[model samples]
Target: MNIQCPNCQSIRITTKDEGKKVGGVIGAIGGGIHGISGALKGSQVGRAVGSIAGPAGGAVGSVAGAILGCLIGAISGGVAGAKLGEIVDQRILDNYLCQSCGHSFSIICHAGHSEPKIVGANFFNLTD
Candidate 1:
């Protein structure tokens, strides 16, 4: 409820909408990287085995390649997703200003962003 503004040390409202678009962009980038990795891996594996399996083997290789690609993509995507989430939570959703004390600080969230908790040391204490 009470967030210290990083700039002026005034308590201001932190809105959830502040960084939603940026977070989404981050996720999309991550997902795209994962997808590309999957595709490349799958193609490599398929090509290696396809020549040996005849027509049926080629089909099987394609399927196997897809599965492998998807698995890798999912894993990479998950990591990217988490990082993106953290960026949103900390940089966008959690920033605020405090009017009462004029003390600006950041509350460490699970993903390393700042949110206001009732009792935590001010992240930036100018006097102290």
Candidate 2:
């Protein structure tokens, strides 16, 4: 479906899918960073525990801790990053720019796609 530009009343509007793709990539990077951080923390804790037990125990604990930490961190980070990306896509990135008048705006749809309205100065600017 195409949206009409509020300023020019032209139907030359398109969805910005590129923004969503960029958001996803950013989210993946953020998730990877978080995962590394979690692994580091887990290894530290494991080392501390192993120090009290002995050399063999410490070695085993460190390896186990690092693996567990990495997994948990990766999953949580990925989920959080994905959610953040989606929010950015919907709120800040997703938009329709008018090719005819250079007007940029977003559309808000109510329940069942009722009362879809443009939410920018072109739609509601009393001064204009």
Write the residue-wise lDDT of candidate 1 on 35-104 in tens digits: 7767777867896789597877877787788777776766666666666666665664443335554443
For 1-128, candidate 2 gives per-residue lDDT tens digits of 54677777788876654555565566656666776777778788898898789888778788878888777765666566666665665566535667887766666432147545443544433323
TM-score for predicted model 2 compared with the true structure: 0.48
| lDDT leader | 2
Measured on C-alpha atoms, candidate 2 has an lDDT of: 0.65
Residue clash pairs of candidate 1: 5-97, 10-97, 10-98, 11-97, 11-98, 11-99, 12-97, 90-113
TM per prediction: 0.45, 0.48
User: Which residue runs does candidate 1 get wrong by more than 4 Å?
Assistant: 1-34, 95-128
TM-score of 1: 0.45
